[model samples]
Target: MKAKMEHKEKKIKKVWRNMNIGFKSDLHEI
Candidate 1:
């Protein structure tokens, strides 16, 4: 169970990082 939770947390962090990068690029486009 602990391992499963850690995997989920890592996936969430990766998604969040991608979102942050996308947001930065959008801002730069303006």
Candidate 2:
């Protein structure tokens, strides 16, 4: 169970990072 939770946390972090990058690019287009 612990391992599963850790894997999910990593996935969430990766997705959040991608979202942050996209957000930055969008801001630059303004």
Q: 1-30, model 1: which lDDT tens digit per residue?
A: 999999999999999999999999999999
Q: 26 in model 1: Cα distance from truth in Å?
A: 0.3
Query: Each model's number of backbone clashes?
Result: 0, 0
Model 2 residue 13 CA deviation in Å: 0.1
Give residue 12's lDDT in candidate 2 (0 to 100).
Answer: 100
Q: Model 1, stretches more than 4 Å misplaced?
A: none
RMSD (Å) per prediction? 0.2, 0.3
Score each candidate by Cα lDDT. 1.00, 1.00
Lowest lDDT block of 10, candidate 2: 1-10
Which stretches in model 2 have alpha-carbon errors above 4 Å? none
Q: What lDDT is obtained when candidate 2 is compared to the true structure?
A: 1.00
- Candidate 2 lDDT over 1-30, as tens digits, reads 999999999999999999999999999999
lDDT at 16, model 2 = 100
